[model samples]
Target: MLAIAEYVVRGALSGAIYALLAVPMSLMFVTVRTIDFAVGAYALIAAAVCWSVGGALGLAAGLGAAMACAAFMAIIFLALKRLGCEDHIIYALASFGLATALASLVLWWWGTQAFVRDAFSDPWSVGGIRLAPQGVINFALILLLVGALHLLIQHTSLGRMMRAAAANQTGAALASIPVQGIQVGTYLAGGLLGGLAGLLVLYSAGLDFTAPLGLTLSGFGAAIIFGIGSPLRGFFGGLAMGIAQALAAGYASAMVAGMVPFLFVLLVLTTSRFGEEALAGGRP
Candidate 1:
């Protein structure tokens, strides 16, 4: 029981990073009706850059690289829009292509080396359960950032604009809202959040060049597990996924542990009305 408790605690902390990654997915889905499949690529690039450079400047450089990649995605998005591409699947595919390209770029540039960094030398004891200081920091930072995002989405005029744009892009455009600009901003925000998640992961479990697709799928699972309608839901979903995976890792095979997120996604899609709504083009 004690061991299980520890797993749960650790899982929650790790899940916070997934929640951060999911935020951009939720925001972009709501605003643009598409998934930014390149989000994980953004994280991977950030980690790769940070690993190569090392130190505080590496962090900045990593984030900059991630955001630059996002800017490139934004340009692709805008170009697609300009070309009169209205299919959300096309957007998703485009992002997937970008993700693949970025992964290849990382592999070509950095090889298959794993990106990792140790931020703390000791674990902190909290309520008799040992926890990594870095994990605690990650959890706290996620809480604050998620809270801020909730506030931004629910209270501010910018949030209102985002919601308006999501609810009806045509109407928002008629209302003189810069829908494209808002979408571009959302992409940039995705980059920031994805890059931050990469840094957190680098300092936690580490990852390799092959991690981008897995990371993207994990974030997507987290985003949709509780319905991608809100960031708060995505936050909880991430925690749920983390806990499930942690429990599996503790008691089951490693392969089973890895399959947890995908299983959750499958379960959600089969049992929830959210999947139906998404397919029918209804707002989640």
Candidate 2:
């Protein structure tokens, strides 16, 4: 039971980090029906900067640097939007190009070496279970993000507009909602969150150039399971997924690590669908 609790905590922390990366895609998909692939790209780039700056500035400064990166992604993506092409495939390809360019730039600036951010020398632990202060910080950020998102969606006119826009862009336009602005704003927010997730990972596990995209894929898997295709569903769903993942990893056969999460994701998706189908059949 003690070991189980530790694994659960570990999963939740890691999940929150990757799930943060997942939310932007879910939110963007809700509104624009497509992902800004640049989310992970910009995050990876920002993390590299964070590592470079870790020598003099520290974690807080590193996060600011990460946010700046997202801001740059927003500006460039919007500028591209002004050129008048929103084709899904085109947008994805363009985002890929942007991500590739940014990664290259980071490589040139930061020499592809890995960085491990040791925030706490004495992590809190109990009975063979260890907890990082940074993990608490990660959980807090996730909660704050969820609270803010909930407040925005429920209390603001702009929030209403965005919800409407997500449901139907044409209708939203007819209702005078600025869909383009919403889209760009989503991109900006998503990029910021993505960068933060990357920073958290650096704070915990360190990073390599090849690691960013892989992390993004992990987040993507979580997003799919968390029902991140919708922002509102993102918060709770991501939490569940993170917890599930941690458990799988804790007891998983050491020889089969790479397959564990994938199997878990497949299981979750299958179960969700099966449950829904059973519910539908029982509705009679």
Candidate 3:
């Protein structure tokens, strides 16, 4: 029973990290109807910067790099919007190209070597289960993010405007809400969050160029499993995925754990007719 409990706790922590990574992607999908393939790349950039610089300066540099990447994405996407490229496919292609470019850049600059953050030399432990300080930090940040999102969505005018724009872009614009500004703001915030997730990932597992694709896939799987429209649902979905993977790795094999996300993605795709209909404000 204790072993089971340990696995459950470990899985939940992993899920929290997955949820954190998924939130930014989910937010962007709902708000701007754009899938940012570069989201994971943004995280990679932050982590690489953090590793190169170290300490507080590294942290700030990492965040700044993420913000800059976000700004660049916003500029390109907003330009696409202005240039009559309204199709989501175009935006997706643009994001994919940007992500590829960024990955190449990071590879050239940072090399393909992997490194972990090692935040705590002595991680906290209880009942034979060890917990990294970085994991605790990740959980705390997830809670803070969820709380802030809830407050923004429930208690603020900006939240209302965001909802309005998400529900019906034309109606929101007709209502005179700053729809474009809201989307731009969402992109910026998503970028920042994406960067933070990257830092957390670095702390937990280290990173290489390949990390971006895995992170991106995991984020999408989590968000899609719960229907991307709801951040809270996505969070829980991520938690579930993490738990399953942990259990698989603990009882089965590490190879199985690595494949769990792909399996989950396929399960959702084959089982649900929705296929991310939540993006259209529909529930999964």
Q: Give the top-scoring candidate (TM-score).
A: 1
- lDDT string, candidate 3, 83-135, tens digits: 98889788878877888888999989878888568877888886788888788
Model 2: lowest-lDDT 10 consecutive positions: 275-284
* Model 1 regions more than 4 Å off: 253-255, 272-284
Ranking by TM-score: 1, 3, 2
Which residue pairs collide in model 3, if any? none
Stretches of candidate 2 above 4 Å error? 55-84, 126-128, 273-284
Query: How would you encode candidate 2's per-residue C-alpha lDDT over 34-61 as one tens digit per residue?
Result: 6667667656766677777765465556
List the RMSD of every prediction in angstroms.
1.8, 4.2, 2.2
TM-score of each: 0.94, 0.84, 0.92
Judging by lDDT against the true structure, name the best candidate. 1
- Per residue, candidate 1 scores C-alpha lDDT tens digits across 67-89 of 99999999999999999998989
The residue pairs that clash in candidate 1, if any, are: none
After TM-score superposition, the amount by which residue 36's alpha carbon in candidate 3 deviates from its true location, in angstroms, is 1.3
The total of clashing pairs for model 2 equals 0
